[model samples]
Target: MGKQLGFYYNSNYCIGCQACETACKNKNKLPVGIHWRQVDHFETKNENNDRQVDRYISRSCMHCKQPACAAVCPVKAFRKRPEDGIVVQDREKCIGCRACVHACPYKAVAFSNQAVKASKCDLCIDELRQGEEPACVRGCPLQVLKAGDLREMEVKGVVKECQGFLKAATGPSIRFAPEKR
Candidate 1:
């Protein structure tokens, strides 16, 4: 693992306990009502089996292949690493116009009301540099979150589910394997 990038979420294994969510908030030191990561649950009934099954979705920054947030940032706050495609923000340069928030289709970009700037998942580059995984992925009890190379993960048959700007422009590097319910 030489500075690789991307996120892999196995919905089949996720418990929707929000450990990832809390971990992200704590690691980032976000104030109340600020979320860099979140868990979403969708429930559906199987007509054939007369059973109800719930699908849990873990969502955050996709750190896309072609990020709209970076493109729309007037101050050039958003950046993507050419080697790994990890999109990040330079807080010092950010003017907090909320342009990135509007440009992002995934709604992944979060504007800090106090800091007066936008923040989102950077895939925890600092942690990776320290030879550690992102806080959320590490804190997950169910071991559902995996971060690494998109090419390698796809080759391993990790099915990806994309939404919003990601579906249109592939703005994030997050992949998901939905559980069959």
Candidate 2:
């Protein structure tokens, strides 16, 4: 790909308000029960400190560098944009085989039971083209979400993977900032 655009998420500042999730649904007009983006919550209380801890992992398609979805799609319905490296799905070409759904480690490829097709994030391609940020990024009230060049978004010393997310061989294009205190 020419340039890989990806997301930067700071779990520390994410309050799990789900505004990002709502914005994504509203912007994409997705089928009912199909979420292009979702927030996963993790909570705990420090045993010694007794301090409550909550972290929200707001995520969607990783838009992997080597997408297993693309490799396994029977109808060649998926393509990574050469210019920006955003993974895209051609719904018309989909066969409802669910192969992509099975192959994605991130659980990003959602099968729409209503539509009998697979759907995932396209990085808000149209909005990006219009020079607007993705709805999820813009919807975050705490400014915890951002999208940009993968390399540029990476934190200098923080781990790319989070509690529930892994750094797969697919080379997921997401970066995570250290959780804020």
Best by TM-score: 2
Model 1: per-residue Cα lDDT over 1-181, one tens digit each: 3334888888776778999999999998988888889888876665477876666777888887779998899989988887778888888998989999999877888888888888898988899899999999898998988888877777656566622113556545777774455
TM-score of 1: 0.89
Tens digit per residue, CA lDDT, model 2, 42-110: 876554657878878998999899999999998999999888999999999998999999999889999
lDDT of 2: 0.88
Candidate 2, pairs of clashing residues: none
- The Cα local distance difference test for each model comes to 0.80, 0.88
In lDDT terms, which candidate is top? 2
TM-score of 2: 0.93
lDDT of 1 at 19: 97
TM-score of every candidate relative to the true structure: 0.89, 0.93
User: Model 2: number of clashes?
Assistant: 0
